[model samples]
Target: MNDKREVFYAKIMLFGEYSVICDSMGLTIPYAHFKGELSFINEDKYTDLEFAYESNRQLKKYSLYLQKLIDDGELIFEFDLSSFKKDIDKGLYFESSIPQGFGIGSSGALCAALYNEYGQNKIPNSRHISKKEILNLKKIFAQLESYFHGVSSGIDPLNCYLKHPIIIQGKADLSTVGIPRNKHDEKGAIFLINTGHAGMTEPLVKLFFEQCKQHSFYKSIRDEMIPFNNNCIKSLIKGETKEFFKNLRGLSKFLLKNMEPMIPETFKEIWNIGLDTSTYYLKLCGSGGGGFLLGFTEDLEKAKFELKKHNVELIPVYKNAKVIDTIKNI
Candidate 1:
């Protein structure tokens, strides 16, 4: 009943899943196939009445949480809490298609939708957004998104809010950049394999942190993943197909060896076939464990054929220079 709402698209991280944890370059983009928006539930219009009501209740709880943080001086920014509360009273819910716990940035989109609708003195999403503004927004968003997950980097909401391709050169260095576009003639593709379940980010992330405690494992991250991952990102943007896949193969192999727990149990055989036969190489979409597994192949059809026996289907996110589909997530 207030102002019109805006739909926030889902985010996908193409590179730097674990490397980002070590302050390496990370790349994330928006996916239009999945999206969310703040909406009010009307009896005649609301089809998922039960979930909508539940969402409203959650929003109410979130509003109170925000208020508490503000009052306690934990969060300094101002929000139109009164208006947000009023909307919740009217069955306000997030109308979204982004799958939760699938590493597609479901909470990130919701956070972006809320901040856009309620936050005061907001940085507008414009054509010329500066690095400083981006950093500031990430700082604020981290606090806001923490209500959903205990500790968030705020990168997920950052992607959903900016709705552009972001590249992180280091921990604090971030900027929007143009990615290589897919060429119609190119057959090579980057894709996603749905694991048919949600991934618990906490445990997998904990595992990564725990692994990092080991000298050899942590050394591999610094020596192996960081270089391979950064080069893959660089080669992709420069349209160097050969170099890109070279590093991609290294990155994929490293994950298979070290991050086994993150990969679903049933997917191991096909994952190896890609590595051995070169049909397609798979990597963790997010923290791993479950959700979507990112895959790359020279031929999409061949990859699909190889996966058919495993009962796995891929949603292509990129092909050559083009964006075929989108994701790593928020």
Candidate 2:
């Protein structure tokens, strides 16, 4: 491209996907392997002009949505709509490698890139977002990301903007935090498996809402699921490997028994095998119907062997130990 700037990285909500809405603990971290940035089309750097044109068109639609937010007084910060239009007309597009609907914050990266480029006044993307500034950014990002997923948690976008590991204690509590360091040869790991298709967040979210209408289902999540979710986050942060896996198994089993629809149909058998053998445990990466399924194990080699029979492979995210302030190879 002629020009590219303002990079935004992908995010993984490691724990507390849907339960975070219920005021439960959630943890997220930036995944530098996938990212997006603002770029111009008329350049010798790219071989795919059509992709850039399509991205430009999508950005045009998003700009229109943002304009409406401004016109209706819903926008809280200074966004330069006029400048944004000029760039779009000149063939501005998002150059990205992040996969959409993968629960890896593709749209969140786009939002971060856009806001970084067009926002006149913005929250500093500081590593130590140890103050109330996190909440302000969350609120703004929630509104910006709503255009993609009808109801946004804003956590994904905030994760992209901050580019740090964030711990969410509840609705009113969130701050960037440190994670334990891992060795290259460590056995315990966090990993992912591709489910072979994209999952629609809107539909899955609607399904979750519908399920919540049933008191029994909601109570199950509150009493059963949230505890598992919260404890996993707690143990992982504290570097309590034994405790983390204990809670992770609980979380995976709970998903298998109750939130089955979130797990893709084809992988259900394999998911069961993980729980039965205790070689590994699979959980919803995000709103999981089909996309990436998050997996955890105390032993990566054993998990790989178990997954091989299913014709699947695990991609390790974190290994050994250590919370990254800025991410490197996982």
Candidate 3:
């Protein structure tokens, strides 16, 4: 049996897909939808034992790889796997509700939970770390998670590590930021519309990379995406939300026109309707295929009405119109 520890949930980046790779602005939050906690179990809990066995089977393989990195001097912090293996045998599986491949950081949450409970150095929450230290931590976490999604953003793991809203400006340029507050009950809110199918990040990202190899597509991404992402950040920062949506709409169209095949065939009509009707602006939440689609609207009711015909699951993001706070008391 081990001590109890709470693991925080992770949210999705509503925008900034491939664009974020090119030094574009990206934003993310910690969704409180699900969480996991560490707890002791009697040796008699066979079900927990079984789950732990399977999880250990997966984690051990990664630990071996991490050990190799440590041996090669590539990784600094090295965890003791012996006790962790023993704990797994004693029933230490994660009891979590975060759904995988749903644009939410399920694997990332698990990685954070494991690191918090078992890592060697264990970054301190009470003590502030340098930006370089934070990025180094992120790189280590990302290395631990490369097995899940071929290439790791390291952002998801970093968010899970920090358990806070993060703003990404470019490669190696990230910092914790506050969520804008909304107090006026403004109908305009960011939302998630479920497309009813799970998305595979690897394949979708692979496709985008292949597309990037093309000269014309590469130019559009450089010229269009980079500018739109910067503008969107500026607008949101300056409280010019109207301009934010306008740029979002533009960015959405650019994705539609250039990244056509990435949009699922079934949802193309609904995707068009959003742009055509001006009801809401739809964009990929994360490697979109059949997972949750991000929507931006000034009128939630109208967006709901316009989107009623489609079997889309709408999730309210922010309401009541307030700027996002960067720091919050624990």
Candidate 4:
């Protein structure tokens, strides 16, 4: 406990943006390229004092809320407020690289790091944590993170907490499954398309919920959107690579057509072009005001050519790993 410990980076849903809410499957992987660390600091050198002070101020407010919950018997464990207060006074803060609203779970990582470092209930071995407990923990973390974003799925924090690949079957059914083998030879791939603007997920998600008030939108989502999402998940899980991308194309189109207003105006034309060109299909990765737009392509080379005009930054993630059997069992 004396040594400083760092939590590894968390890779979020390679797919399943909003579809997962209604029970569509979600796939997540852990990426080590970005991460956060927790440490005990000696109050001597103060370089980024201003930033630290602001972060501490925010953390203090959250901690007080948590303390209140514990006092009301809502939370099960007692929190060590004295030590937490001292750390805050010394300018303690979460140091992170995970981007917010890019859908990689930056806030989730922070919550996980804090829970790991400060939560009184000891982390029993991961093996000892039951499925129910896992879900419950995710729920708790999600609630904690709602302070940042109005509503949270908790999947981000859950992935950060577990630091492993997790698959969601539906709202109530979630489990960890093995990933299929990644075919390095396949020219087909999935990628992140930089939208050149940072998106605010809370606002976008709120808009979606507001739109859901309309019966037509709600019905379309339940009928068209959810089915497309489920099929995409199935195709991907079953190693049906061709079918997976095909379904993604359908999903991208559906979103563009039905969820047009949700997409930022800047990305509208490009999104439509991708669909019409049939070279690549673009969909919202998270809430999508800006940030990264998810894309699927049958031929990466052609997709590159078609997208060259946009000058978008294409980041490859699951180049080789496309299906379910590729990952090792838990």
Which candidate should be chosen as best, given lDDT against the real structure? Answer: 2
> Which runs of model 3 end up more than 4 angstroms from their true locations?
37-57, 67-73, 126-129, 183-185, 320-330
Best by TM-score: 2
Give candidate 1 misplaced runs (Cα > 4 Å): 43-46, 182-185, 321-330
Residue 229 in model 4: lDDT: 83
Model 2 TM-score, all chains together: 0.95
Residue 79: error of model 1 in Å?
1.5
TM-score of each: 0.94, 0.95, 0.88, 0.87
lDDT of 4: 0.71
Screening candidate 2 with a backbone cut-off below 3 angstroms (N, C-alpha, C), the clashing residue pairs are: 179-323, 180-322, 180-323, 181-321, 181-322, 182-321, 182-322
| Winner of 3 and 4 under lDDT | 3
Q: Sorted on lDDT, highest at the top, how do the candidates line up?
A: 2, 1, 3, 4
What lDDT does each candidate get? 0.84, 0.86, 0.72, 0.71
Error (Å) of candidate 3 at residue 160 is 1.6
Over 1-330, each residue of candidate 2 has an lDDT whose tens digit, in order, gives 224476888999999898987788999989888888888887656537888899999999998999899889989889989989999998888889989999999999998887788877788898865559999888888989999999897899999999888899988799988776653237767799999999989998899999999999999999999999999998887778788889999999999999888889999999999999999999988899988999988888999999998899888886664434235222
The alpha-carbon lDDT assigned to residue 65 of candidate 2 equals: 95
Residue 302 error for model 3, in Å? Answer: 1.3
- Measured over all alpha carbons after superposition, the RMSD of each candidate to the real structure, in angstroms, is 2.6, 2.2, 3.0, 3.1
